[model samples]
Target: MEEWTVKVNHCAVKKEKPQTDQLEFGRIFTDHMFVMDYSEPLGWHDARIVPYQPLTIDPSAMIFHYGQSVFEGLKAYQTPEGTIQLFRPEKNLQRLNRSNDRLCIPAIDEAFILEALKQLIYLDKEWIPSAEGTSLYIRPFIISTEPYIGVAPSHQYKFVIILSPVGAYYKEGINPVKIAVENHYVRAVKGGTGEAKTGGNYASSLKAQETCSQKGFAQVLWLDGVEKKYIEEVGSMNVFFKINGKVYTPMLNGSILEGVTRNSVIQLLKHWNIPVIEEKLSMEKLYQAYLDGELEEAFGTGTAAVISPIGQLSWEDKDLMINNGTTGELAKSLYTTLTNIQYGKEADPFHWVEKVSEAYAVK
Candidate 1:
């Protein structure tokens, strides 16, 4: 495995950290961030952990012109005994490489980045919130930073990982959400960048999101681009549905993101001896299921929310309420189970949580 780091010139560990209960999601950042440079010829270099701050970039950087950027989001939680643990770090690493390949970004050695990430979290250990809903959110990204604005991949790039202290993603305490089923604007197509965590895929969804908001929906549930019938994914997370004691989700058809939370939920359900099916779930089938009263629940999953239940779905002058506009039994159980493992409240038999050694705990 490759390794790289330049010792921090100035450490920004919080002097008097605020209470975790008062935190807002992704607002309070830890003292330091990890950054590095990558070029075609030089590979990766100048890797370092620096005080958190805004980056200085040329106005005409390639990323600015061509949207050549990709990013991943995950979190580290402070257990009851004060250990910082990350859930399925390897999954994020693998997904990052998949995004790198799709975006033509230089990929870093996973071990190297993971090591650097843990070290940074160790240095800012005090900033990690220990409250029930608080966690240290990590955002790792790669961007084209070269001055030239040509369409081709830039020679210079930046790989950075920043930490933020976040409260639970469901600020309103997981009161159901309304999603506007998107039939006009598609989030990703088969040959598109949706499967990859590239910025362009998200950038393309902004307008649709705006339209959804204007239509009084919390999010836009996207469908396949070509057929416009099969459900693809929700705006930022993959979605799941429960019907008649079975769990079903859209298969990875190169038009949807394979989210970490989605995968975890699948494992957890299977562990509970529940049947899970990954197939093309279409809007018509979902509508029919809801009409038949077979659809028990629907929810979206991501690192941010873990699980957010969908209370209502609106499409073309019609409204469908899931489980009477309340968080269903399945949604509630899934959320509780996942968070239990995250905060060490439940037995993590799957060994999903990776603990940071006590020796490296910042004193």
Candidate 2:
């Protein structure tokens, strides 16, 4: 494999950084971004780190018409020693390729992209917040840029990475939140785009999420699309339930996304000698477990929230209060441990943290 070089273009003007205490998730962006263009013969080329600005694409671009796009999310944390690091970034890049394969988009060189991401983060390292629950949120995405509006995959595409200084994903932070079981709209079915981290999967979930939000719920617990009886996920996050001292999460099954955070949580549980099972968990069975006083805890895992405890689950006019509407001991421990590892405050037994050196940003 040939090595790829990224060119850098500094921005003429800089934007004022937001106060770390008042930072909100995805609301503020950094000064620079990384972009690369792809075409047939040259493949992915002309990789560059440029000033953050609006993209100028043709109105008839295929991404606007057919939605041939894929994205991945991760974060960069500032440690107490002022070093910048990433958590399981390789997993995100691998998943991005999987999404590209599923969407019929061209595959990117994961190693090269990872280097480019490190350089980009190094350039904007100042934007990484050092607050208790703050970090620089990273969004990497690819979009079809071909001008043709037909229903086929595009020959041209663009890969971009942008950074955002973010605080907690939820206003409730690590506290427990209310969740509603979605019974109407389905997010995805087996043999669909659910397994891929694509925009269409999230676009299809807005209706159910909106309804639940209006009903005073923090998020909606999505059910399986075909049967509408099995638990799938919780509002953009992978869910896990603790019933009778065992942790259970819905199996991938070609529809549920393979979340990086979810995998880490399972690994952590196993490391602690906890039994974690992945299988098709039906809503009926879970509710029965709750009735039997076996559902001890419930939570959702994702890159943004990390671990959001599901305090109350409302299903079919029946509210299931989990752990007396408080964060469970295991959930709290997992959150603290994961965040501590990311921030370099604890020993990283899994070697999941990848440090970004200042030399990467040197011209």
Candidate 3:
């Protein structure tokens, strides 16, 4: 990773930072952003961190028509000691490259990009809210910039990273949420770009998500595209269930995202000697577990919420209540532990938290 050039924002007027209580998700952005361009032969160059401004892209850009875009989400935390840190950010960047590969976009230099991200975070460290359950959300995205687009890959691309100070993902705090099982609509297929962190996959899920919202559900529980019986994941996160003292999550079957929070929960469960398995989990089996009085808990893990307990799951007008429609013991434990580690309230036994200064400096 090399040094990144920084251009200070000299605008006389600046947007006021929102109050900690008023910090909502993705609504407010920081003052600076990182950007880089890519083209054939020259590769990725002109790396710089400039003031946050609107982008001017041609209307005929390939990204506008072909939907060739990939993005990754992560957060920077302001510890109680006033230091900024990142949790498993390298994993997000690695997944970004994977998405790039799947979307036919150019792969990024993971280490260099990581360093650039750290520098950008450090530059806008004040944008990281100090309130509990709040942090600076980092969105790194790549869009195809080629104006003439047909069906093939584009030769030009732009990668940009922006920061947003976000409050809690759920307005009600970490309370359990109701989810509606999506039986008619499928989010992804096995042989498609399901596993990639791209916009199209999420754009395809909006209709189903909107339908669930009208039904008074927080999110949609997606089933497999082929069978529709096998569980895949929930909207924007990975799903997990506990039955008979054992935790189970749907395996990565080339159709579900490999979430960093999901992996961390699995590792944490195993470290505590809890039985955890990654396999093909079916909704029918989960419903059967509920019938047998063994369905103990259910939750969704992601960067946004970290751990969102699922209190009720509705399928075909039948609802299955888990943990008496409250946050489960395991879910609470996982959320507390993960947030503790993120905020530097507890020692990171897994060595996942990376301080900004060390991450920016070379060995």
Local accuracy by lDDT, each model: 0.86, 0.94, 0.91
lDDT per residue as tens, model 1, 282-302:
889999998888988999999
> Candidate 2, residue 120: CA error in Å?
0.5
- Runs of candidate 3 with Cα error greater than 4 angstroms are 1-13, 170-172, 358-363
For TM-score, candidate 1 versus 2, the one ahead is 2
- The pairs that clash in candidate 3 are none
Indicate the residue-level lDDT of 44 in model 3: 88
- Candidate 1, residue 179: lDDT: 95
Candidate 2 residues 84-166, lDDT tens each? 99999999999999999999999999999999999999988889988788899999999999999889989999999999999
How many collisions per candidate? 0, 0, 0
**Regions of model 1 farther than 4 Å from truth:** 2-6, 12-18, 359-363
Clashing pairs in 1: none
Q: In candidate 2, residue 326 scores what lDDT?
A: 93
Ranking by lDDT: 2, 3, 1
From the highest TM-score down, the ranking of the candidates is 2, 3, 1
